[model samples]
Structure formats: C-alpha cells, structure tokens
Target: MSTPTSDVHATSPAAEYLAFTLGQEEYGIDIQKVSEIRSYETPTRIANAPEFVKGVVNLRGIIVPIVDMRIKFKLGTPSYDQFTVVIILNIGHRVVGMVVDRVSDVTTLLPEQIKPAPEIGSAMNTDHIVGLGTLDERMLILVDIDKLMSSAEMGLIDAVAA
Candidate 1:
C-alpha cells in the first residue's frame, strides 16, 4: 500500500521554462507556451494602443501583437540592440510576441525548486507570477504567460481575434 503524500510527490513532475531577461531581472515562462524566437524588428505602430503594447508585426500571414515586457513591468526605459529578441508565444488560441532583452536558456525545475511568490498586497498584481525558480546561484521569476497575455487589462487576445 502507498501513502497519499507519497502519491502526490510521485505525480509532481519537473517543468521546463524558457528563460529570458527583462531589464536586470530574469524571467521564465513555460516552455510549451513558446512558439519561436526571432530577432527584434520594427513593428508597425498602432495608434491608440498602449505604450507597452509596442505594435504589431506580420509573422508569415499572421499579424502578431508585440508587447514590451520591460515597459509593461515598469522595469526601465527599453532599448533595442543586437541582444533584443521577440519570444513568440501561443497563448490560448492566440499568438502573441513578447520583447525581452535576451534569452538565457531553457531551464528545468523540479517542484521542490520552485518557491511560492510572496503575498505583497494589492499594490502589485502577482496573479500571473507562478513562483521563483532557484537553480545554483540563478533565480528566475516564473511567469504565467497565458494569464498575463489574456488578462482583461491587456485587452490583447480578444482584440487581436476581433
């Protein structure tokens, strides 16, 4: 006979995240959400769109909206350079692109390696933050890309579809 606690432990599997940098902080998103990575390019400006929502770019036949994570998180002034890249993500049925400083590498984290995000009150929204991943001396702010992209305030997914 097996214990319930042991069964729960057995079911918890390791998850892989695509690590990237936004300003000085390192962020990680679920690997499955990543569609592809492309070098930064100037996107056609959309009038009335939020500043963080840089604009849209034609990806093949699809028009993908690009969101600058730096601006969205209020990290600092964003700069475009050789290291800049767009991480195309497949969230829900919509495709979105996220601009990041640079991509680090894919990291696999076990359940034990992830720490719960602290409850810091309503001043900041932590709903999209999965947890903090610790590996060696590196710490990654794991983000729930799907939730962040689909949030009501973003108005991205629905607007793009329509």
Candidate 2:
C-alpha cells in the first residue's frame, strides 16, 4: 500500500517579463510582446505630434513610431545617452517602439509572486498597470503594453495606419 502526499509547496506556472528602466523606476512588459531591442537613433519629427511621441523611424521598409517613455510618464526632462535604447514592440498587428533609459534583464515570476496593483486616488491613471511583481529584493511594475499602445491618447496605432 502507498501513502498519499501533499503538494503544499507547488506554485503556479511562471511568466516571463522584459525588465527596463524609465527614470528611477523599474518596469516590466510581457516578454512575448517584445519584438526586438535596438540602439537609440534620432527619428524624423512629425509636426503637431505630442511631446512624448518622439517621431518615426524606418525599420527596413516599415515606418515605426517611437515614443519616449520618459516624456510620456512625466519623469522630468529626459537625457538621451549611450544607455538609451528603443524597445520595439509588436502590439496587435502594429509595431511600435518605446525609448527607455536602459534594459535590465528578463525576469520570471510565479503567479504567487505578482500582486494586484494598488487602487490609488484618481489623480493618476493606472489602467495600464497590470500588477506588481516581486523577486528577491526587486520590484517590477508590470504594464499591459497592448492597452498602453492602443490607447487613444497615444494615437500610435491610428497614426501609423493613416
């Protein structure tokens, strides 16, 4: 006869996130959404575009809109240096690029390691914030890249199509 055993230590499957920095805060996006990471390059400016929407760059034959995450987040004046990079993302059927200070590393988090985003007051919009992931002493602000890139305020998808 065999005895039954408990699996109390079992954890939910892990999800991977590509970690990057904007200003002083560390943020993460679903690894699957990241198409590629490229070095920073000055993109051609578009008139009447929002300050955050840096401009567009040609990737092969594709015109990709680039947004500076620092400006979009109101993280104060951004300084583009050697560490800056553009994280090309594939959102839905569109491809967009977001400029970040620097990328850290891809982190894997178990379901238990992620906590729901706190409900803050209405002064700030937290719709894009998916959750907070904790690993060791590091905390990652997980963002819903799809929601963010498709939001009307960015006008990224519509602008690209037009």
Candidate 3:
C-alpha cells in the first residue's frame, strides 16, 4: 500500500529570474536581459543628468549609463555599501546598468507563481512592475527592466547612440 501523492508539478513554463532588493522590497527581472553583475564602483559623473542617473561607466570600451533604481523609485535615501551591486543589462542594441541594494539569487519561477500587480493609488509608479511573484513565503516584485530602462523618462533613447 502507498500513500496518496500530494506533490504536483506546476503546468506553467518556468523561467529564471534575477532577484534583487531595494530597501525593504524585493524585485526580480528576466535573467535573459542581464549580461553581467559587477561590484559597486563610482562612475564618472555626468553633468545635467537626472538624479536617478548616477553617471556613466566605461565598461570595457563601451560607455554604459548607470541608473539608481532606488532614486528612480523615490525610495527615500539610498546608501551604497560593500553589498551594493550593479547589474549590467543588454536591451536591444543598448547596454545599460542598474544599481540595486544587493542581489539575492537567481530563482526559477513558473508562470503560475507570478500574479499581475494590483492597481493601487500611490505616489510610486507601477508601470514597470511586471507582476508579483510568490515563492514559498517570499514575494518578489518582478520588474520589466527593458521597458523601464528604455522609457523616455530615463533619457536612454539619446544615450542608446553610444
């Protein structure tokens, strides 16, 4: 005699995500957009650039623009420490970088695990929020880095010429 099986596999397709944190919230992005992860480095400051645009870093021979997600999201004050990391992403023909508090890990989440973000009246923008992902007891705010980084508000359209 065998006990009834409760273990069942999710029917939804699985995709890997790069999980990161900003303040008290956790976020995830499609791993395919990520090219590399580098330690924090003070980039060359660009004059007249927005606050969220930290500056630009010469990655190899390529000049990459770095954006601070915390500042972009208006998440109060942002502090950079040893744990800070920069995720290099390749969107279309443009390569950009984003600064986050710290990267947790690469997680594989099934489609069923992701839920559409609820619309709520808040000062924070949710346009870039892909959805909310539920994994065990943790919830991740999945971000559409492509859309967010390439948006006109980011002023990356001009920078893409680089």
Candidate 4:
C-alpha cells in the first residue's frame, strides 16, 4: 500500500481520492481503484493499439494496458520526467495504467465539497467526471475511472489509432 504524505488532506467520504496532476490541472480517482504508482517507464508497443494507448507494461505477472491520459483528455503530450508517474488502476476487474504529470497527495473531501458536473456550456467533457471537489485553496477533478476505461471507448480509440 502507498503511504500518505503530510500534505494530504482528507475531510470525509469523498476524501478517499489519490490526487495527481496533468499539465496545470489536478485530478483524482478513488484510492480503492488504484493498485500502485510507479515512475513513468516506457512500455512495450502493442501492434494495432491506439495512439493514446501507450501500449503494455508488465505489472507483477500480468500484462496491463497503459493510457496516456494527457492525450485521452485532449491535453497535448506530457514530457516524461523524474516526476512523471504511471498510476495503475483496477477498473471493472481489469488493470490499466494512466500516465500523469505527477502525483500530489491522497486527499479527503466532505460531501458538500463536491458538486455535480455542470451540464451546460462546459469546455471540458464531463462524462468521465463524477464531480468536482473544492478545497479552501484548490479544487480537484474527480474522475470515474470505470467510465474513463469504458471498453467501447477503448475499442474505438484502438480501432482509430491502429
């Protein structure tokens, strides 16, 4: 299990997120869904896979697919650095990797700190977002990894980029 750092802040039920950054924004997913976080390492290419799919990496004994969340989210490519990380997440019994800029903390938030994704005129797609959590000085984008890892969408991304 990953240890929580002193900068981590938790409030209540929603406070169970593992927060990370991609570019300038901060995002979070439920900690229960995460298996591990490792340094951003190059993965072996899988033929016929999507461009956004960074191919596969061996985790323990299992081969897992890795996704560059920057490309998936329409953000430009992120430069790999010492701080870059591949966060392993288990969604619907399948393990996958998400490349992020850097991990920040394990944070907690109260129910009131979270709000439903706005439906109208939003610049970003809200489909994968469960809600937005607010801290006194910052906010975290709460993601529904299952939705983000939807097989149909994965197939589409793969088919198009292959």
Candidate 5:
C-alpha cells in the first residue's frame, strides 16, 4: 500500500512560515519570501498615499515601502513600541517591508495542516489569505504576501514579476 507521505509529496510540500500578530489576529507568511527582520524604525512619510502606507525606508541603499498590517487590516491602531519590528520581505520584484506587532518563531507546517478559510464576504479581503494553518493548539492565518502586495490596492509592486 502507498504511504500518506507519498501522496502528500506528490501534491504539496511542507513549507516554513514567519508568524506575527496584528492586533489580536495572528498571521503568517511564507518564510522563503522573507529577506530579513529589523527593529521598528520610523520611515519617511510620503505625500498622497494610503493611510496604511507608512512611507518608505532606506534599507541598504534600496528604498523599501513600509506597510502597517494593523492599519491595512483595520486591526485597531498599532502602538509602535520596542517589540514592534519590520519584516523585510522580498515579494515580487520589490523588496518591501511590513511593520508587525511582534515576531513569532518560524514554524513549519505540512500541507495537511493548512485548512481552507471560510468565506467572510467583503468585510475582509480574502484574496490574500492562503489558508488557516493549524499547528497544535495555535492557529495562524496564512497570508499570501505576494498577492497582498501585488493587488492594485496595495500599489507597492506587481505579482509574478515580469
């Protein structure tokens, strides 16, 4: 008889996720896309940008745009503190940065551990939600950072780099 591992490997592979929080909701993104994590530092504000766009930062010569997930997700106003950190993500062609409440340890989840998220209508943008990752007692909202940043609304960059 074929083992479950054989089937799982054929369909999908285990992947690492970098977990973080925005208000009360815990979220994660693919670890492969994460370039680095830096302490929260105030960025230079830009003119005529969305409220969520906290402006851009100079990271090793590259001007990276910073997005506050709390503000973008409407997860209450984020109080910037020492614990806050910017997750440097290499999504698409743009190396963007996101300000998360705090950084949780990187966790690896098998394909079976990710479950489909229930439809919640337009109240929440589901386009970026890859699935709900259940690891033991904790559940993480898996986010497709690629899609989130590429969406016309985010305006940072494009998906499927040309």
Candidate 6:
C-alpha cells in the first residue's frame, strides 16, 4: 500500500485549490488566498473606478472591494441572483470580494493532471490562468488570483488605507 506521504508528494500545490463553476466552465483558485465565502450582497459603488470593479462592501466591520469575475475576465456581464457567491480573496495584502456564479467543493489533483493554460480556445484572457487540472472528465481552470487582483487594479484598497 502507498503511504500518504508518497501520495502527497506526487501532487503539486495547485491541487489544493477549490474548483467552482463560473458561467459554463470550471475555475480554481488557491484555498490559502480564500478568506470566506458568502452569498451575493449589494455593494456600495465607488465612482471613477474601472468598469469591471463592482464596488465596496462592508464585510462585518472591514470594507472590501468587490469585483465581478465575469467582467474582469471579459466573459460578459453577470447578473446577480441568489445563486451568486462572494468569494473573499486576500490578494496583495488586501482583502477583496469577487462575485462568482457559484461555489464548488475543494478537491485535490495530481501535478501530472495539471497543464499550463493553453494559448488558444479560451473564452476570456488566458493570462490569469495558471494551469488546467484535468480530473476524470472535467477540467478546472486554475487562476492566479494575485495577478487577477493586483494592487494596481484595486487602488481603492490602498486609497482607503491612506
């Protein structure tokens, strides 16, 4: 029988991310960056920000900016509903919320199952995708959240700090 250590060593850290459905495709992000998951809540809008920036919301006592992943990825505008979820991400030392279609369970995949993002045939920009995790018959698009929500893209977070 193979020991757990051997099993763990066989896979890469990318396997630890939580995979979820965005639009019609699957996407994954490292679980370490995820703070909490909540249902969609209307956020207070800020003026003069990028079109994709959803706005800021009061999560408990902390104010967090929310970005619609659909718009950020150029996947098209998203409509908020009960099914939508706010995925709170701690990227670049700032806590921001992102609206996703839904939340899926966390699962692990072997390193061999993950392939670098393909150059073509993707609906949205492939720059943010770190790799593709093939599990069974499904594929999870692994995302680099730090790159997606860089400090430059979320200036408001810094502005509020000053």
Best by lDDT: 1
Single out the weakest 10-residue window by summed lDDT for candidate 5: 153-162
Cα distance off (Å), candidate 5, residue 89: 0.7
Q: After superposition, how far is residue 76 of candidate 4 from its true place, in Å?
A: 1.1
**TM-scores, all models, native as reference:** 0.92, 0.90, 0.88, 0.83, 0.88, 0.83
Runs in model 5 with CA error above 4 Å?
1-11, 154-162
How high a TM-score does candidate 3 get?
0.88
Sorting all predicted structures by TM-score, with the top scorer first, yields 1, 2, 5, 3, 4, 6
RMSD value for candidate 3: 5.4
Q: Tens digit of lDDT per residue, candidate 2, span 14-33? A: 89999999988999999999
What's the lDDT of the predicted structure labeled candidate 1?
0.89
Off by over 4 Å in 1: 1-6, 154-162
2-23 per-residue lDDT for model 4 (tens digits)? 3463223242344589999999
Candidate 1 structure quality by residue, lDDT tens digits, 96-116? 899999999999998888998
| lDDT for position 7 in model 6 | 88
Clashes in each model (backbone N, CA, C under 3 Å)?
Answer: 0, 0, 0, 4, 0, 0
- Weakest 10 consecutive residues, lDDT, candidate 1? 153-162
Candidate number that wins on TM-score, 3 or 4: 3
Q: List the residue pairs that clash in candidate 1.
A: none
Over the stretch 3-92, how does candidate 3's per-residue lDDT look in tens digits?
A: 332123344468899999999999999999999999999988877778888888989998888889899899988899999999999988
Model 6 clash pairs?
none
- Pairwise TM-score winner, candidates 1 and 6: 1
